[model samples]
Target chain A: MRIKAIQWALSAAVLAMSASAFSAPPTPAMLSNACAGCHGTHGESAGPSMPALAGQSKISIVESMKGFKSGERPSTVMGRLSKGYSDAEFEAMGEFFSRQKPFTTSQTLDRAKVAKGAELHEKNCARCHVENGKEIKDNSPVMAGQWVKYLEIQMADYHSGKRKMFDRKAERMKPLSQSDLDAIAHFYASVK
Target chain B: MTIDRRSFLKMTAGAGAAGVLYGCASTGPSGSTADVMPKTGRRVVVVGGGYGGTIAAKYIRMMDKNIEVVLVERNDHFVSCPFSNLYIGGLMKDLSPLTIRYDKLAANHGIKLLQAEVTGVDAASRTVVTSKGTLKYDHLVLSPGIDFRTEEVKGYDIATTPEVIPHAWKAGPQTVLLRKQLEAMPDGGNVVLSIPLAPFRCPPGPYERTSMIAMFLKQHKPKSKIIVLDANPDIVSKKGLFLKGWKKHYEGIVDYRPAKKVTEVDARSKTVLVEGLEDVRGAVVNLIPPQRAGQIAVAAGLVGADKNWCPVNPTTFESTIHKGIHVIGDACVAGAMPKSGYSANSEAKACATNIVNMMNGREIVDFSGINTCYSFLSAKEAVEVTGVYKVDKEKNTIIAVPGTVGVSPDLSELEAIYAESWLKNILIEMST
Candidate 1:
């Protein structure tokens, strides 16, 4: 009886030891779950700083991607991430995100900041960004529900000669101070 | 207070399922198919409850109201590995912020969390076989994270020497184990910390950990010394700030040794055998060995390069090695990107969108992502690394979106405040 018990224990131990030898493969969604750290849930930016990818144009996404991959555009993390995917995947991603609805960015905008921003926007951004920053012309994205923080950062990027844009309208804001840019962003957030 | 809305849902099944579930979906507990919404043909089973898995489960449900989502993880409460260094550094005592209950995610987003160890995967049948039972999935999302390549370190086996020389790489029991060993070690003792090369999760994690340990030693065990045996030539990420930190603060306490690879271990004697240097003995050894894809990823034949890591299409994050299996986290290769929680969370959001679109037969489009990592040099001072990433067609990889990679100008107390805020917001995203 003692011998039998020892043998049984030995077999069970061996089975358990061998069980950890291999692990199953994970899914694509599991692989990509790492992005929620900063981007927010479902690619919706709740932190009021990051851009919302919930609803954006496919062409805009693809063009930005092409720029990143080719080194025409420079990014800290995106350049590395762009190098990870195949070309077809970029088009597919553009389609996927474009199909989703936009996240409503309606955090209470500071009235003073919005008023200051509106003054800046009237002098600089009203050309392409039409009345009240609502209707944007020439494939420009609607800035109404966009994150104020992202807008400020992009403006800084343009001013620093980091990102080059064809829009002459952005050139006017190149001379604005950080406070002015913040005011403009606050105004944009309040538009909707 | 816990609210039971199932009785109310029972009364209002007449309203459109989508409308009734709109914004108020957290009514059921996670786990058991009977408890969650009825399973339709559209279903996704996510493995590993880390940043990637949880984000996928939550986002997929948010995308579609009727799609039943099941998340399988071994642990009940989710622990964040991102801020665990603070806990080890003696700066953070309350561990409540690092952990999140799945009940909130299930109750709020209508997700089913299955606490079980997955045993096997049948790709053809689209079924995940777990210890509890088998589950059929229309789409299988695997965010199993990373596992160490233990065999690389000769004479050190996790099974045998787990207690004496613990590697608290994972954020759970292993972390506490390492902390206890550090606490128990006598003053004037030596701590030998071995760090692996790149493609490992959190390129800057090992350095941050070194700083934390050194900080603890300064406060409690002043005479103790920490020898960092780095496999890389120098500090891999956030170099200037860390080098400055070492010079300004931990100059005498830390013995930084770059280009020294730990090859072997003598657990009984508490010694680590380096490639070029003499065997160094210590009172405590934190050996973070070279890493690879989770064992499950290798077993499913999804791994590449001598079964070291998995290669997936950067677009969909689907395994190039397998038909339908998608791999993420520390398991797969992302070009020019470090495997960090920030990177994982970014990837999870994109992958979730792709999976939902593919399930509904909607068109898949391209999207860019970003990662921002903040490493603390001390309890009050920190630095940062932030960047934007996008898919490159000509290179066929995920690349940066042209000139946005920004490292910190210098370590600052303000950056430390930002770091804590980042952790707080990330925890909120994971839990609620």
Candidate 2:
């Protein structure tokens, strides 16, 4: 409700902004305009190859952006993007994306494949990616409802030594097969 | 791996769209269940899926959930005309990042992405005729960009033959061709680049191109020299900075000639005759010819008082020449905005807003947008120009807000880094 009031006030402020030298400040969504073409608007990406940023925990969003900015984390596009915003802006964006309801596209679920993935996830990956889609750690995002292709590729990339942030993640992921990856992706996708 | 241009565009463009609307491409709504579009809904047919059209299609869906949006484009993949100069300059290697398909728009926004040419338009009945079939629309938007005035040059028509001379302006095969010729030329050879008159897309682009190529030659072919022949009397944008750049780093390797026009070209002889000067001979010739609104725009009767371009109401971007038809991007003659990617993007937003408002019977709100264009002086040093615009009701055109106009006072490496991020951000905004 307060966000609505702020929006109304911003719009009213803009009506008189033209009379002054500088225009009204950009709205959070407007400030997020740079990310729309690739990341999807309001952080809900339609491309399965890319992860949706919407509805994630604010801590994960802020930490990931900060990590990319400081080169503690690596990314092709995100690293460059992280440098463009300030620490305050990153926190604000974290809040903005978190506030947005996730708009994930539904895929036809394979009941057998999902069951297989759930078993594997519970035995090997449950310590990090918890049940019910919530993370115990602040840096890890909720894996439920993520684009399936993004998850599959990330898994394969991690195992094949393409993307690396943790030696421990590699140890756990190294033994997984192609079907195992697919099943795991579907398992989380099928989660509510 | 060896997919032809057409099929490659189709597959990559639909990489994400395959699961949802991929079947829509092979047939109309009658043949496939995936192509279902309700007959009762309001439809918007956008011709050309470049910056202006894509943004308009996405925004219409965002602002009003009920409206049906269909984007008609010839290419399955979009190749950004911006940042292509970097490809030519050897600063960038891969063109894969520049190519984007329509998968995300279709999957996320419920926009129908059709890969086909717009053959004709029945303006009176609001019908867009395409290669596949006809689509009826409540509103039609044309962002078909620009076409080179090939005939204006005595020896060039982009047909029959012109391989020896390449424009490299439209960001396709020509961009690749110019780069190859530059790499092949001997270190001692002379390279000539011709600049068309004002109002061409990206007023500072020719200068930026010259700088990139000079930077490339400075690394690989150190002995070669670049002579820039300008039809306009001076640098069109960032005049002082470009002048300083030419004098500072490129002093011995770069030559600048102003107020000189290319009158004739003999590709076989590798010569271009410049006004008031001797025949300019070169191993490579980058000729940016006179430009006009793209063919589709002219075909749809969107051109108005300005014979070469489309005249749109500055606020709404609706064509003054044709009601119910709007034009944006480089095709429209915006009062003060340069024909640039940033300008097209801003125009698309305003155009989309007014479009939704008009459909809802809401009063039109006044608006114009902003543009910030950067030019690299070298591989590391860069400068920028930015402006804000508002509608002038009396003149019926958008003009730059006078006091807000800004240009970088000096060159900086930081500005160059910002320039790279700017391209990255823009690509993200237009496509994913």
Candidate 3:
């Protein structure tokens, strides 16, 4: 998994460089506007189930596209959609989304679950998602202020083996029950 | 001077034959005597305020604020056809949530909203004649959606008696009428829904309507049945999923008879006469008749040999027959792309981008878009079909990429939630 991630990073970097060489490639807005139907204008999703793409880490976005395209990641629709875009388009979209302000859901969160979730995050997820998942890292997604429902769905996918995660992350997730994961999702959602 | 219908048709035909000779200098025909809308710099006048027109107007402004955009719509409010089935099935409470006002679009994007019926388009003159007045444009966009061919279905005149035999295809009042008819139907009554052939708006729509109506019947009128009369040999989209859903939830409630094409309808008796089959009687009859491009598109001579849909250069959505005029949404012949609101929204964005590029002398990029359509089998469970499309330069039309189109393996509640979210986000994108 680590080796594959490294290869994707390398190829994305090469593609990004080649994309800049074009005289006038499509503007990032033009490429990304195609996603506005579900992802919202500028990637700040209006719906709670869909994840907001605005302010996501460039590497994370690029990796997710590669994963979906290669069938290494299972998705309801992204697997098919990701196949349509080129690696260069993915790089452009990554840059485009990373520049926008992060979207914070306006949904009401359970206070008790959020309080419990903070503790769970520190114990299980703090190692990789540092700063309560607020600080965006090179390879990590920005979890703070994400939709709780979307987070819950992703966690379920990881548990069901529908989506593959890194070994250490998977190991940490193994012991967490559904309620525990729900609390963790609430905590992440409560960050903003 | 008031001209009769016969003379008007004759005058238009003469003008069409001599359009090239007349050029942009001649103002073809005088419509309303109202003053023409003053043109300011580079302007694009988009006719119709549906998904395609609204998004194109907004995105064009987003891309370049300098270019003036005018959106002309007949109706003041936009009622979506996407979720109207829910309303007809009694799942959705009212149409208020589905109806969107254009005020925000005008205020947020600085678009000029003209509520007027488009009478004609003089392509050579680069002007559109509406009931209110005439409007000149550097570029014109016609996204007028679809118009029904009621003549094909003999003895069924939707224009004259829509309340009696509702198509409810365009939503709004027709949707309300259909729901009312369903509610008034007796417990053991039949509801006959006749679907037109393929290439009609929303391929999976008739099936979804069937499921929704079945859901209503299974709850309120258990003994009631819905007779689905499809012209095609089989279901056009999500065939396996829809069949499975019907078998699982609506067994004995939905009587699906494929290849049963409607030949005529007796409105008074509420009976549908089918080809090669006996007549089917129903308390409520829904006849989705054959359709072509909207009146304005056809008047502009955008439709090609098919005479049903407009052919366009997929990259820019510019009309193949008429330069400087683009057509999008269900009105255009989008190869392999289903006629749905999502497809229209996607095409609108691509069209807007290309228009802005053309105006600024920039290179026009190839067109690429995504379409995701979800159909509810029941109130909670739903199935989806998604596709990613790109323009085939050789064919000059959009085609789905090989590995980028498929339906959901199965229906689920999660997909239903996603479906709602898709609608919400798309509404926000188009309206605000």
On lDDT, the leading prediction is 3
Q: Give the CAPRI rating of model 1.
A: incorrect
**Candidate 1 chain B, poorest ten consecutive residues by summed lDDT:** B18-27
RMSD of each: 12.8, 13.3, 8.2
| TM-score against native, each model | 0.69, 0.67, 0.91
Ranking of candidates on lDDT, top first: 3, 2, 1
- Per-candidate interface DockQ score: 0.10, 0.04, 0.27
Off by over 4 Å in 1: A1-36, A42-192, B1-40
Error of 2 at B101 (Å): 1.4
Tell how far residue B66 is off in model 3, in angstroms: 0.3
The positional error of residue A78 in candidate 3, measured at the CA in angstroms, is 1.0
lDDT of 2 at A40: 59
Q: List the residue pairs that clash in candidate 3.
A: none
lDDT of 1 by residue, B226-275 (tens): 99999899889888888899778898999999999998988999999998
TM-score of 2: 0.67
lDDT of 3 by residue, A15-54 (tens): 3332113224456776788888999988989888898998
For model 1, how does the per-residue alpha-carbon lDDT over A79-132 read when each residue is reduced to its tens digit? 555654556656666666566677767577788999888888888888878876
Clash pairs, candidate 2, are A37-B428, A37-B429, A37-B431, A38-B428, A38-B432, B13-B101
